[model samples]
Target: MNFDTNLILSIMPELARAFGVTMLTWVAGVIGAALLGFLVAVARRYGSRWLGYPLRLCVEVIRGTPFLIQLFLLYYGGPFIGLSLEPIPAGLLGLTVYGAAYFSEIFRAGFEAVPPGHVEAAECVGLNRRQIIQRILIPEMTMLVLPASVNMAIILLKETAVLSIITVPELTLVISAIGSQQYAFVESLFLLALFYWGLVELAGRLGRYMEARFSKYRFVTA
Candidate 1:
C-alpha cells in the first residue's frame, strides 16, 4: 500500500487537538498519583498494622490486576454502584489509581533505603516527625525515587491510549478512527507510533534533566 503523506497532513489538526487532550489527562493523572502515592507509602511504612495491612493489600491488588480491567470497572461497572463518571474523569481516575500503586512501591523502597540512624539523629536533634519528614526524608527520598517515578510517568502517558477504548478521544483513538474512516491504516498507525515515540523521548530527557539538577541530594559514600 502506498504511504499517503497528504492524508497525514490533512489530519494534523485533529491529531494536534487529540494530543492536547492526552497531555491534559497525563498531567492530571501524574500529579494526582504522585500525591496519593506518597501518602500511601508514608502511611504504610509508619502507620499501625491495621492501617498498613489494608493499604498493603490494596497496593498488591491494584498492581496485580491489569490496568485495562481496572479502567473498565471504573467506567462501566461504576454506574451499577451509583459511581458513574464521564469518560475523561473515569480515565483520569483510573490512571491515577493505577499509577499510584506503582509509585507507592517506588517510594517505599526509597524510604527503606534511608538509614535508620538518620531518623534517630533527627530525633536526637529534637526535630519532630513532621520536621524530619519535610526537611530530610522527603528531600532525600526525592533524589532516590526520581528516576523510577519518571519511568512510571512515561508509562502512564502511554497508557492514555487505552482511554480511547472508553471514548476519551485521546491520540490513539482519534488516529485509529481516522484510519478506519479513510482506509489508511498504515499512515494512521505510523503517525501514532511517531507521536508516542516523540512524547516518550521528551519525557526521558526531562527526567534526565531533573536527575542532574538534584544529583547533589543523592546519597554518596565516602
Candidate 2:
C-alpha cells in the first residue's frame, strides 16, 4: 500500500483543532494539578494528622487508578450526581486530578530533600518555621524540583490521549475519527504519533532550559 502525504496534509486543520483541545486540557491539568498538589503537599507537611492522613490516602487512591477510569467516572458519573460537565471540562478535570496525585508526591519528595541543616541554620538566625520554609527551603526546592516537574508535564501531555476514550475530541480522537473514515489506519496513526512527538520534543526542550537556569540556585556545599 502506498502512503498518502496528501492525506496527512489534508487533515492538518482538523488535527490542529483537535490538538488545540488537547493543549488546552493539558494547560488546565498542569495548572490545576500544580496548585492542588501544592495544597496537598502543604497539608501533608503541616496539617494535623486528620487532614494529612486523608490527603495521603487521596494521593494513593488517585495514583492507584488509571486515568481512563477516572475520566469515565467523572464524565459518566457526574450526570448521575446532578452535576453535568462538558466533555472538555471533564477531560480537564480528570487529567488535573490524576496529575495532582503524582505531583503531590513529586513535590513532597522535593521538600523532604531539603536538608535539616538548612532548617536549623534558619532557626539559629531567629527565623520562624514559616520563614525557614518560605525563604530557605522553598526557593532551593523549586530548583531541585524543576527537572522532575518538567518531565511530569511531558507525561501529562502524552497522557492526554486517554481523553479520546471519553470522546473529548483531542488529538488522538481526531486521528481515530479520520482513520475510520478513510480506512487509513496506519497513515492516520502515524500522523497522530508525529503530533505527539512534537509535543514531547517541545516539552523536553523546555525541561532542559529550566534545568540549566534553575540549577544555578541549587544547594551545594563544599
Which candidate has the top score in TM-score? 1
Q: What TM-score fits each model?
A: 0.97, 0.95
The candidate scoring highest on lDDT is: 1
Q: Which 10 residues in a row give candidate 2 its minimum summed lDDT?
A: 213-222
lDDT of 1 by residue, 1-222 (tens): 999999988988999899999999999999999999999999998899999999999999999999999999999999999999999999999999999999999999998887777888899999998999898789888998999999999999999999998999899999999999999999999999999999999999999999999897777533
Error of 2 at 208 (Å): 0.9
Each candidate structure's count of clashing pairs:
0, 0
Least well predicted 10-residue stretch by lDDT in candidate 1? 213-222
TM-score of 2: 0.95
